[model samples]
Target: MNNYYILGLDIGSVNISAAIAKFSPDSDNLSISGIGRARTNGLKKGVVTNIEKASTSIRQAAKEAMKTAGCKPDRVVVSIAGAYTGSVKSQGIVSVPSGEISINEIKRAMQMAQDNAIIDKDQVILHVLPYEFKVDGQDHIEDPIGMSGSRLEVFTHVITAEGNSIRNLIKATNMAGLKIDNMVLAGYASALATLTKDEKELGVGLIDLGGATCDIVVHLGNSIVYNDTLPVGSTNITMDLSRALNTPLANAEEIKINYTKLLESGVSELQLPTMGEVSLTHEASMDIVTKVIYARIEETILLLLNKFENSGYLNKLGSGLVLTGGMSKLDDIRNLTSLMFDNIPVRIAKPRSVDGLFEVSEDAKNSCVVGLCLYGSGEFTRYEIDSNGELKYKDSHLKSMTSTKSVNSAPVIEKEKVEYKEDKSEDLIKISKISEKNAEDMHTFTKILNRLKQLF
Candidate 1:
């Protein structure tokens, strides 16, 4: 009967999405409890512009999720994306005094690698993911612990962001009456929810196209090698359409969303509801819309491709590309991307293996938030929210946990035992089925208990 809840909030330029999941002590699985979303304001290109407006959006989204889950969450794992987000790789080597690598030696090597990294004074490290360990010049050693080697070396990919940007996000979330549990790069989170084990192992690229930003992460050897965020995204296309067609922003958005289908239909003309029933011909409207959309999307994709090429990992990607987020849902985008990438394999990614409210679990736009929940299920640092809505670190180092002590009577469980293995597809399939069944059976009880717990 012991259950724990975890909340993941994705604050983006276009919208704020929140997802709540219940973790059970007896099972290493996450059951979706509720999901909520609200239109976002006060932000542009994933950076907070107005704290009060951003806080209001976050509060509204969280409140809707809390009402659906029937419990209030004091803390949340949040997703961050912007042009300032980036990653760099560094290597560290240390001599093992004992001639055998121990955990301490590994930690020291990682520390050395982190110290060797060159970062700006205003930047803060978000994640230091070790790609591999080498023992005595031997490469590809997954773990060096207990290995007899005079020297231990570690290669790590470190993610960093502008410190002020992070502070702004923290300030907005705090004002929303929620404490930050952990912050994950939006690209990393989306990859967690969409990219499969095979794709990651064989080398792949994930592109999360949001409203105002395009987040890119490259994975190889089952680890992140490079990540960056571009300032341009789907909103640019909408703006282009708005300007080229001389239409309102709302109407332009509608056209952009349906542009592909409209083009495919080969209609000569269309009537506009916004223009007082004025009829627009394809030669005038569709061509302009197509040209605007194509130009912007092409520019964005080329820029991303150039970044990948510059990273020197472009040739290493065997799985090609997996696209997710709101823009990926656009009709014909897959073909468009494929053509741009010279027919490299491209597929639109949807959230899978997530047992939750149907809409959120299946939506590409919710990938980051859902992935935040999945990321929070693993080992992470803990933060505390004071009564006055301030965030404080509970510890300096990352902590591992199997359950969370709720702020009230509700117990929260963490799915620490659940591990995703590349060769264990059958196991994952079985687990997915079991989770789905559990979700179905617990549907009623979850609603009732959540409502009851709200009274406390």
Candidate 2:
């Protein structure tokens, strides 16, 4: 067996997370090189704004990861999430003339549905999750690949993204000098690293709380059935603190991370930063802490849970809530999850059984990026590609493989004639527009400074 090294990167509005790991054929273990995180620039609310800034940060991140993993970059799978990603379940049915049907016919019928997929001009398909397949009039047939059937029906989950979202991401990665070998959704990455076989089988709700956005994914009966994202998270809490206490964003972040607790830590007022660990005491203004955070986190959870409930298939909370990400690290968040989710178990999901996790026991906090690397290294080998530009799968993307939901993996669209020819006309126009924008920004900055001087 050949040894393969994998790099996973999760890019967010506030931070860039990178991890490097190599797999050996001799063992089922992974050697984690290092994990790198840095404040993000050039992106806003999960979308790339300035390619130069994003690329610079990304380049630095890659270099840092390389140093940690002790290996130069070879391949990387980038993780993405944002507003433009939409998920839907579509089904196709066809009658087979013979009493028995081969896997080829069922698969071909599903392909016909995918062919008619609503791929718009500004969007690209990211995933094709198969929910269930039926034979003849039978329902919930797991795999029809070899089963005999007169009629084949497949239920699938199709995920699509805004073309510009991916285009800008690819552009930034290219500029940063990383090969865009694969693109995986941030939710999928987190699930891969956190959710277990039983959880996916019974149903699991994985919520990733990041700086600027919150990604929610529910895996029921072992495959992803529902996914929804909201444009708010830890950063909003930071902003609230900043505006409330008249402090810089950096200072507010410090307060939230070090002082804030899920429930009242029996204290209200806590120091911004006291050298190291925050000592929780009765004298601490527990009210103040909860007052600041409860509403913010409460509202966030309510909105997200409500969205999941509305989905019908996700409200049951079968596997409970597994919260991850930087924001999920807030002390006692598990308590809040219980109050908000009710009856369903809520626990912090950590990345166990992966290499280099000893430095941080809370691997779930960075689960998405790390999981991306693990899954990128053949963990999501549910996809198959043959000669010609055709992509085939054993089942739809949402079907569970083991006891858990077996996501078909990110869909592969056959490479087409990429018109990479330089758009000289558009390039020239873009340059002029960029120059004009820069000049306008400088003028605005100067105006603000002048106004401040006048006030002083």
Candidate 3:
């Protein structure tokens, strides 16, 4: 059991789940030794509204995981998702030095594009993904490393969010007594664990339906081409059910899981009371509740469709939508989603391996946690610290802003990854998804602070 130890923690609205990896470095396959989970009470819609409350939930979950793993988790990777998360596209280009394009030139172009695209002062750029590069007149090139060209142009997908929201998340996590080793974008984490290389290369739309947020990621031609977060999630379905059935929220959720309806049943002959959990005096057909629930789910789908269509990724989809997350466990979910998008195949997906627990309907739910372990195990980006203890990018490849003085020069290369479970001493702590309990809602922040703010 001492093979290789890595901890992955996924903080969600409904539950906090963790996994300890028993690394079999001698083989390709991995085993998850101890999986721990606890109910989450301090979060709302995937964001921490109350730091103290959120911290309590995280600490409880971590403590359980630590006991199971038989050791304290000195280093951890946390997932981040909030209402402020969003995406946009940008392009960068540079004349080929000596009328010829090299791998370095292409890399420089990507950095330029990311630097040029960031317009908000308060927003923090999370991921700078170089989707594709065009060398001279040739296009659709995934890598032009050995190719020759007169100019190199790059198109990238930029994902960003409110900086304060991210800071709040970090603060709460620190308060919970866990040192975060890495910060991974939640949707990307989900994709890496669930999406096949072919699916990502051929272009697929991954829709992860969560409790409070529906995340949309468009992976096409090898990288994520677009991403966005919709405020609506599975919780909306519960709310709609409660309102339509005139029952309490808890009972509505119970009915959603326990009830069933024939796909073509234009009418539900079953009777349900509108007032309470255990009332039978008045009987109303159950069809109304089902249809109402279906309608709300459809609207959320439509919202995603609109985002995809408007982003021009609708036509580029070669691989159809892949849906996952705890919310994707609903019965006949594919059938309901199929009707919303024309000719698009919809299916539930889950983590391929390293499993012990999986609810039949929680394809999307496991993706993030599983992906976090996979991400921490594999090296993606690197970060460093200054005398002041602030976080700084270890490599130029990850810099959001290209320094004017260093733009034309080749940046220094560092030694590849070496393990260190050091605490983040004075690094930036991320707080995300400002809910009502966080003292100010995102809407309120946006309205009051009309001035633009810049962040890394």
Candidate 4:
């Protein structure tokens, strides 16, 4: 039995969360062993402002999680915010040399697509997800491995991030005594944890509203097609409240949480302390508080709505929109969102299920962290490009499948027997067996060539 531990860390502007999942290779279930969170101090709008403070927060979260799990995880799967992320769609084509497509042909096409993408010099590719495939004159071919085709073309959505920002995150994690197995987009991670397979296939939009940033992701046909971020979030509302009501930021946040409701409410008045002079107290109207919160939230939703409309995926979201994160817990957020989104179906969501820790699954704020665990436990794409930009096969964790076999169980195909002529007049014959999985470990040449200067 190959039972392993996967540690997922989501370091955001408001909080740094860590969760440990115990997974068995033979089963589809992921058991949550522990979870921990700490207030973040070194981040502003999800970008690390100070590596030392970020590392301290990461250490605190990881240490607490490990202590609860009674074991230290060697490598962690971390989530990167969408603030520094960008995505582009590209296509690659190659002739089928053997008149049939194989893994090599597929890899070549994906590498060509990566090469075709135009990006800034300071950015690194984070994910290369294939959304469509064309074989010869045919279009939308899912897998053309065994199909006869003269040319194989693949359309992929590539996600990239600023190199400096990624390096800073990596450095902070390393300082926290954790090696990163992968870095996933926080938006994509949240979608993975909250979205059902049917929703992905039918097209769905997910928004993760965090403390200082709102991350957007559109999923269609089992892959993310678009990813974006907004600099405004729940913190903006708090600031607006502080300014509008002439109150301290702490008190403003409390009011936003407890008093303000987007919908109508009867609680009309509250005793509020002055901003600079807390000793002096005054009565504040709940109507003003509600309006302040509503304005900021409405602005945020409109910005997100505009972004989605411009992405060309607005009409494609047949399954509608799903909202998660800390701000989604705000009173009447779903009702307000539905009204803003033209009454299209809107649902406030969190992690769909968590085996051990109920708290993690209960709160929408923990979506990204739980999704990181799912991603780490092989609950993502079948083929993925690792952080090192190598093509790797990931076993699907779907429960509907009859088998949960991994690459280690891949079939070994015997090579054709060969005979060698020797000068000694004796013929040597040999047969060799090679595993199909071994041939899939090919490096992405485009990334390697682009980063060759860094290797020196």
By lDDT, who's the top model here? 4
Per-residue lDDT of 404 in model 4 = 30
Writing each residue's lDDT as its tens digit, candidate 4 over 1-456 gives: 556677899988888999998876676678889888898978777788898899899999998999898876634689889999998787777788688888878778777776666666656778888888888879867667678878888888888877668767766776676666678889988998999888888999999999999999999884788999999889899899889888899988887777535234567787888989959988888778878887888999999999998999999999999999999998888999999999989989989787888878999999999999888677776555544455655533333122332211111112223233323333232222211221135357735753442222
RMSD of 1: 15.2
* lDDT per residue as tens, model 3, 193-270: 888877777678888888888777888765776777788887788888878767778767776666554334555554
Worst 10 residues of 3 by lDDT: 408-417
Tens digits of lDDT, candidate 2, 1-456:
445567788888888988887766456566677778777999987788998899888888888988887886445778878556876566666666565767556555555445445545555666666667778778866666667756777676666666567767767776776755567778878888888888887878888888888888888653677777889989898887766655567767777887644244545455443223345312234455557777798888888878777878565567788898888878767898788776578878777566664553365567888777766555652432211113445343122212122111222353332333122222110100001112234567765653343222
Give candidate 3 regions above 4 Å deviation: 1-3, 24-28, 92-110, 146-152, 260-285, 355-364, 379-456
Model 4: colliding residue pairs: none
**Whole-model Cα lDDT of every candidate shown, in order:** 0.71, 0.66, 0.64, 0.77
- Which 10-residue window in model 2 sums to the lowest lDDT? 428-437
lDDT of 1 by residue, 101-140 (tens): 7666766666566555656565666666777778888998
TM-score of every prediction relative to native: 0.79, 0.79, 0.74, 0.84
1 against 3, candidate with superior TM-score: 1
